[model samples]
Target: MTERLRRALDARPRLTRWLLAGPGAVAAALLFAMAMPIWLPKGAAGIDNIVFPLILVPLIWAVVFVYACVEESLLRCVAVICGTAAVCGLTAAMAFTGWI
Candidate 1:
């Protein structure tokens, strides 16, 4: 690891890093799940809606996991994750309200 990377990792508590990173990954997944019904085209008796989102969920989570781990600031990581969750929640709400 580069000196700066090592220093960044060393500066935070391991548990705190995990706490932030874990939720960021989980939020990414939930975002994908929750957004599926809202944004996916409903076709073939709804299989199309379910299939693509399920396929993308892990990809989304992996990307978010890496980003959360590599990001330099804990607060910014939390902000990104929480913002993602909020957007997902809002989109799901819109679906329920027949807005999508």
Candidate 2:
């Protein structure tokens, strides 16, 4: 079963890579941005957290996308992207639940 799944994924490398570089990167970036507010310190007017995440979103996306595209190992790329998204998502969720 695992061999078959591996073969199937290997059959269409471009499609897999595109999927990772596109939607996967976007999701990771968004999750990271969402969690940023929880850790970022407020400035004088108390809006730095919001504004900093907004400004960094595009850069984060680009960095993730590039890493996904350029990485030699597809599995590693997936792991990194998913791990980042999961961590950030958990952070945001914990914050929302008042656990942080």
The lDDT for every candidate, in the order shown, is 0.74, 0.90
lDDT of 2 by residue, 1-100 (tens): 6566557667888898998899999999999999999889989999999999999999999999999889987767767898999999999999989999
lDDT of 2 at 58: 98
Candidate 1 regions with alpha-carbon error over 4 angstroms: 1-15, 42-47, 97-100
Worst 10 residues of 1 by lDDT: 1-10
Best by TM-score: 2
Task: Report the lDDT of model 1 for residue 96.
Answer: 75
Q: After superposition, how far is residue 74 of candidate 1 from its true place, in Å?
A: 2.2
lDDT of 1 by residue, 1-100 (tens): 4565546745775765797568757876777587886667989786888788778888878878888779877656656777787888888878878887
Backbone clash count for every predicted candidate, in the order shown: 0, 0
- Model 2 alpha-carbon miss at residue 90, Å: 1.0
Each candidate's TM vs. the true structure?
A: 0.66, 0.82
